[model samples]
Target: MDHDWMYKASYTSEIYAAGVQSFLSAAEANRVKKRSRSICCPCSVCQTFQYFEDITEIEAHLFENGFMPRYDCWSRHGESLAAFSTSSTANDTTYNDDASSLNSTYNNDSSNLDENDNHLNGPDDNLNEMLHDMETNMGDAEIENLQHLFEDAEKPLYTGSRLNKLDAVLNLSNLKSKNKWSDKSFTKLLVFLHDRMLLEDNELPISTYRAKKLMCPMGLEVERIHACPNNCILYRKRYENEHKCVVCGASRYKQKKDSDEVDDDEGPKQPGNNIDVYLSPLIDDLKTLWDLGVNLYDAYGKEHFQLHATIFCTINDFPAYDNLSGYTTKGKKACPVCENETSATRDVFSTIIFDIMVHLISHIVQEIKACGPVFLRYMYPFERYMSVLEGYVRNRHRPEGGIIEGYTSEEVIEFWQGYVKGLDSVGIPKTRHSGRLDGHARVGFKTFSPSHEDLHDAHFVVLKHMTCLAPYANEHMQMLRLTHPGKDDM
Candidate 1:
């Protein structure tokens, strides 16, 4: 609020702008001859300094790490600074008192001081009160009278305590904790770990690696990978002693399930430390995604391009669109384009399409390993998992568009030609289909001769509008007797 701080902010902002223009010019020159000058940095501040290397790096760090909105961000930072300045501000308490006494008609102490002031100050909740008190009373300006209360309301039952109470609550004496041997839940666990060989540090944190060799169409980056890529997702055999293990995917959580707990008639009990296991939700997530992948293939191969959004429509209570089947074309209720329920449904799939893939794969490994006895087939371990995946596709991962390729125009054409056509029409060699493009069916959008750039834009449009499905992915995987993220460190 002071002129000094205001002047500094303006100077900093201008510096940010000047830096971005430099980066943009450089990036534009680097683009392919036919490609658009679309040098996307995603970080708005970085976008501003598209040309300056040093300033752009600074902007990138700020955006990637503490990328909060301006006012909230500024207010939070100010609150932190005020916290550190408490003693100094107290030194100003006398100054405030002297200033207030000058206006003897005003009683400031009676204004800002209140019962809740004894407790923690609510962030947004105190804004209106602070303004009212500042206008009415003079005591609010006193540093001693205006002590800051750090509220950690974001954490449930978090009352400014460093020690976690949940751990104690979980460690009670007489609780008939789950016996992992239940036919419902086997002691099996899934261990999925992927550590890219790249070293990382605070400077270049979460070293991103492209899985170029991973047979995936849409390449992904490993944020914190170390040499080993674990789980079914990494697509390599687990190197440890996988045989004598119950195969639980827990890494560092103390899961309950004694080896001897299972009955003699049921099966042989595997042995281990049993508590600390390693599993990421991404594994089982892949299994569920594979099912959707199968369905997509089935639908598209047979020219069943009715579209995933069409299949999702059969689910009751889902939102529908005007001109869409089951909804009247005229007099139908609709909001703005983004607010439309149809887009919401599509987005549920589009955004989560890949996350679903990750979660499905993660779940599949955990389900078979953790719930070994209950698991029947080697392929489709849990029957409910298929329905879970379908429900997720319909209810959760729904995207405005049904694909998750993060596509560009060129990529879109390649998808249609290499994937859509190869699977449904022309043949691709030596892969899941084995020496020829696997499966059969008429596919629309194949050989449809669209410009390369248009295809990319369409794919990006689909991805940009995509949404993720976390509820179901977290649900089934946890239900399968595997440890959840909050339950473990890894």
Candidate 2:
């Protein structure tokens, strides 16, 4: 009963071993009462979700990985509240009797139950709940694909094979990606396996395209929402069927194409101030989350609960802040907090520039007071992410599509990486100097002697960029020009 050994003692310690032994005995008793061979393993790795029939395997897992943190209750292993309290005997008896009756009824009518209902009592309760939640959002084709994937997951790659159909396909896809295999090469390999190796009857895909299609259900679904050609608004909700832009009055489709698809090359490069229109979907989702909340499974708790959230504050650069906050970030009255009280200064030309950015600096303290901290609301992370998105844009003419495709591929690769362990990573592999300090290379080093000209050039470059030497360098240059009139300054 003293669960302190879980955290205080090492897995190999006598206290921990005794604790695991006691836990297994109780769990085994519970398993026998439920007429089940397997009991949920409460080890950190298994987390009470994965079931194990062999008691020795469960014990080994606990010894190797230790029990899941904060599992003192043992609720899943049949240690109920009634066992701790004698006062609840009458209420516990009544509840148990009703539960037994319900269980008997369900068992008697098992044949009439739906496929989803059958999984309700199975170990894959999380998967069933997730699929049920996705049903409302996914199309018929996506749902069918997901169901097929689920079915394939249970079937082994071959007789007595440890890997399932899903695992085999995922592992193969990961290998192809990591090795940078060409489509033709992958197809040939698949052909060799299926034809020559005699694995054609198994669930192995014969082509790279087929394999990708099979793995489609595992990737996140992308919704292609249409937006106004003029970047005024998205053609959704109220403008779901509108032919022309409500604000700009421009036709949604290209005149030459005579179709609903707008030419990507012809549209505005960026949404500019109309970004709010593009963020309508995100805003709606946030509003729903704040109001009604969403049902999400808590892995640690082993139950579903309503998750509610709201944006604390927006983090963006000045230009983006102007568009999202609907405040002018330039000219006079640019400071939203100061507004009319913004201070102005005249330049050397006696012109009042009214630089909003300079004036806004004075009110940074007030902004920080309202928004918690400057670092919390800074655009450093967003700017770094923008660089990553820029790298994804292979096709400059259709940067949006390029980024979406690249990002989706990365997401799928990442998903596969989670399932197919021990494979080489999918993206650009990290260099040896990844976590090293700037200018420090971890690779084998070589000494180099710079020539006189090279050394001079390097010193000149370093001195030219040094802020402390700037005034002196400028003064020396002025002296040189004054001392040698009509001569080249260099």
Candidate 3:
């Protein structure tokens, strides 16, 4: 797990992150019916710190619309921009430095900065730094606040116990995070995580987050569940250091909760704050589903690990969507498969890898008329596939509602290439993109004019993966059969 990218976000004003931490702390407080405190955020990345903190009342607008596909879509999504950058493959050759860069925050602690922030009550140095940094670059917090104002915790019309992986990834027609994530940021992060997991192996270290436990259970006996100031170690460390790590002699001492660093005989690090291991519990749960082929918006299904693998394999990768207006679109309601409102979104999260698997499985089962080859020969060891899938999943994937609308043709095209090649290990068609005769699409050209070709490329990656999937499926089965002979039927 090249966790170097773990704390990548600028470590700035992610209100969503703050909110989650607060909510986690609050949950640990006495007198709560549910150990979990649910706060509403659009998705993981786009939420605000306040949102994570349980700053509002709970209410939900039940939506009823959209067709419910049992699982995620094997091939769907309006690829205005997503299709253009289909060059990135899960394969190594097409990896880029920028995608990784996007998730990581840079801490040039070579300079003397703050020390310990022991007193959460005192002015928190870490929080200050993040706030300062964000104010400098993003200007004001108008956008963040406004988005929050309109946000709602309305129960998703799509309710379900669980879903097939493919059926509802982006379904509002379906089922239902945080760095202090915002709705907008949540959408952005989802897209980021999806691409990273699907494309960048460096992002995921755990080949697969094996379903060893139903929950990421932590013992309060070993570690304090909530310690204010301690709860917000970042702030406390900054204050304690009098805003600097005393030992380092460099203002930036390695401490909990601080992003800035002081110069030292040693090189720079993120102050090694206690927050390193600390994560929003709910957010982590959200991530769990994401790894299992769910998206941020598919928050309706809260079931942990124990799910039907057979159903999971079929519904993982539904379709990608694009409604720039970013509102609920009316379609169908009261799905037959799950008795939930068929939302534009579903309860199940999804990923490109699972989608690919479903596509290939469907073909081998129905089209090729033989699931044996895929199960035996092409499927990489389930562990390796999952290892790679995790990395792909970790990369900043599609945030809640999905990617924002303001990309240029070139950017979209570039992203499309990166996504497909980096994610599926299959290259998109060059001809569809209007090559400059060398069979390569030229940079900065207007080659992207939405064609049916885009759709085929999106769906074809799954088809192509089928070519290799046969072997992996066989191996996956072989391994599973040995371990859980009774359950290998999936």
lDDT, candidate 1, 302-385, per-residue tens: 222222221221221112222123443222122222234433443444544533223224345555667564225343434444
Q: lDDT by residue for model 2 over 298-362, one digit each (tens)? A: 64365568999999766678787678877777765666676675544323223454465666566
| TM-score to native of every candidate shown | 0.15, 0.51, 0.15
Clashing pairs in 2: none
Please name the candidate that would achieve the greatest TM-score relative to the true structure.
2
lDDT of 3 by residue, 88-122 (tens): 23233221234223222112221221232111211
Cα lDDT, model 3, residue 1: 9
lDDT score for candidate 2 against the true structure: 0.65
Q: After superposition, how far is residue 389 of candidate 1 from its true place, in Å?
A: 13
Candidate 1 vs candidate 2: the TM-score winner is 2
> For candidate 2, what is the TM-score?
0.51
Task: Pick the winner on TM-score between candidates 1 and 3.
Answer: 1
* TM-score for candidate 1, residues paired by index: 0.15
What's the CA error at residue 291 for candidate 2, in Å? 0.8
Rank candidates by TM-score, best first.
2, 1, 3
